[model samples]
Target: MIYDLIVLLRQNPTAEVCHKSIQFLFVMNVIALAAVQAMLILRVWYLFSDQKWIQYSMILCFVACNVLSLYFTIMASQNLKLLNGTIFDLGKHGCRASRPPNFYRMFMPSLGLHTMLYALTAIRALRNRQIFSHAPVLKRLIRDGGLFFFVVFATVTFTAVGSFLTQLPRINITVIYSNYLLSLTSIAMSRIMFSIHSLASNLGSSTEWLLSNVELSRVGWRKGRNENEIIVERRCAGPDDEDYYYDDHSVLDIGGGRDDDIELAHVDGVKVRRSYDTSRSKSPMPRLTESRVGVYDDLTW
Candidate 1:
């Protein structure tokens, strides 16, 4: 579209064409910028999941920034005209927006939004540092989030400076520069999201294993009267005592020891039980109902 606009401008320089081109540029630029903000807001929402107040505040900021951007874009579009008030000689390469009085107002909220998101990400990273210390994927996510924030913030600052420079008589290409910066912002935001998604996919199996280990470590278990049955107990008390213990029908023999039983074994610490001869008429093993006290409870890291 930009190439086509340049070609049209070079072929036929007209006020209507110039106005339409400027309007198109402003609309596209605003849409791209809004997409970038939405992506960042989504990341913040995911990072602070289930926190209603934080989510609401981020959403409110996003909405306010977009509203301000749209308002300023409309104001700029309304004020757009050919340079030097001459339609025929606007520019052979492209058109320029007639600087509006409050052109910078549109982008100020975006800067504020980026700053707020950056702070939120930093806080979240700090708070969860210990919990996710062993998970490199989450660490990379925080790092990438901060890097994207910096990139977008820098672009916004450059846009603001360009907006100011447009006041100078010699600097007439602020619109082009601002559009380019906004496009870059969109690309950077999208790339960040893609990288995070790719990393998550690569780490999905490990994450599942970690979560499973944590869950196993949280639950306590005891041997049932029947040798084949096991009693699983939740470490945390449930609503009622009756709901605390449940019979697990699966057969699990720890170590073939008469009294020894396994609780929550680490991924690499699990010992395989000795296989018995099912063909022989072997007597049933002694029922060991002893509670494995403090065995799995200590498994909680």
Candidate 2:
């Protein structure tokens, strides 16, 4: 009955219309496949940032799948030729083929490709979170794994339904629908990868700025507050009949001076005195007082 129905439909099947639909679907699927491959390649590259070996392994798996897919496509084409008489069946002349490469060959391989790609995406996302944070394992799993499950489940459901209910003998709706799902997945994954990359770059920039500021502050504080001994030179002409001159140099600790006299009561191991110089020729000796220097003759007494 099914074959009869198919034959009945085939009696008046519009070759032109089917041809155009197939062409449109073909173009869409090709573009979508290309997009998916590109996204996977980019994700693999991202993994190389931390795990080059893992990235290489991923690349190898992807390459192997593609190579096998290509081989199957070729084999399927040859099978069509043996069974249906031609491989390039756009319409009437090639319409008798039992199944095009799209139905069993290309489409089957797509299942594996999309699955692996999504799984890897999820793994990388989880790994990145794990490395960067100390968040609970369950939270990270729920975040990353949940997303992966949603995407994979959606793709699988759509592909299965479209494949099962499609007009298989004439049209492989699975391929069309798979292309659509893959396109969506590709877009979502690509956006996610781009966002992650941008976030990491901004974080690194912020951390670098913070470190530099800390270093600068340390240096500035050191320059502003460090204690250093400074030397002062003084030239004095002694009172004499003839010309007489003497140079006096003294070293004072810049930070050793007190802001107030009370703070200067203790000077490490040295006793406090009103003046260190006792040369009467330079100036009269100043008496020391608690409040005012040179105000008393014997204030300490």
Candidate 3:
């Protein structure tokens, strides 16, 4: 029963069959357009999360393009089927519903929109290297937008251009296959872009982690230096004739171990001089001084 039904459908008159097919295809195309808009939504969120203006502009563009293009594409498709049935080769009863000029006008602007989207995606990816480095979300946005643009742009451009040129009597296979070639090129570019985005994201994450660790280490090291140089107070007895004298405190590192000379001298009832191990010495020896100015001294031998 199913085999017979399939055969019956295959043998149906072309014009009537195409009219029905167009109706289904048109709906499906609208659904696909909706999916494209969804991709744009995701892309805008990822690419312009920081820029309110860009995000709003993206929403506006999506609404405008989808509303306009879908209406035109459907209208043009219906008009093509009507024209095919009534005007062109009415006597011959096969599916003669071919491409229409109105379809091209409706379709061309959509293709242009897609191309702009792809270029925008690529530019956003290049510009937001910082986000790509810090998060995978932005990278995915770039990839999705780029891939969607490439697929739709190539599909529409190639189908329209190649089918029209193939009508030429002595055309090359390359011309006929130009659409396929463009599809392949777009696919290749999409893959390359995806790979680049992935690598860029990984590098971004690694760099951020490294910088954060370095900052933490620097903070720890600064605290450690403050601990190393500590001031302390100590009182020591000074030497005097039959008298116990005292000296003011001295600074020392709490963790450091050094020997100090206890000998001292007094001046004006205060211990003014002391000696310590050269390795632990903290004071400079006094020297006689004389002042001179405006001297440019040079020695040449």
Best by lDDT: 1
- Per residue, candidate 3 scores C-alpha lDDT tens digits across 1-301 of 2332342345335566667665555545555555655554555555555678777776777677777767776776666534344566455433444454344444454566566667777788788777553344445556665765677667667544543553542332343222343345445555655654554343333323322423223221111123322122335465443253323432222222224344332222233233343443355632211111221112111
Residue-pair clashes per prediction, in order, are 0, 0, 2
Pick by lDDT: 2 or 3, better one: 3
What would the TM-score be for candidate 1 when compared with the true structure? 0.63
In order, candidate lDDTs are 0.61, 0.44, 0.47
Give the lowest summed-lDDT range of ten residues in model 3. 288-297
Candidate 1 lDDT, 1-301, residue by residue in tens = 5654563557545668777766776777778788878878877776776588999999998998888888888887787656734564554555544566657777777878888998899998888888464444456668888888888888787677566675563443554434667767768877886776565344332223322434234444444343332334433332222232322322243423334443332222322232333344465643222222222323421
List TM-scores for all candidates, in order.
Answer: 0.63, 0.40, 0.45
Candidate 2: global Cα-lDDT?
Answer: 0.44
**Most accurate candidate by TM-score:** 1
Model 1 ranges with Cα > 4 A deviation: 1-10, 84-97, 134-137, 166-172, 175-178, 204-301
Model 3 segments more than 4 A misplaced:
1-9, 14-17, 81-94, 143-148, 159-301
Cα lDDT, model 2, residue 59: 73
Q: Write the per-residue lDDT of candidate 2 for residues 1-301, one digit (tens) a residue.
A: 2332353356334545344444444444545554666655654454444577776776776677666655654554444321223454444332332444443545455566666666765666666664434222223333544475467546755564455444653335344323556656666666655555443343322222322323223221111111332223445456322233223532233332222333232223322332233344455533222111221213321
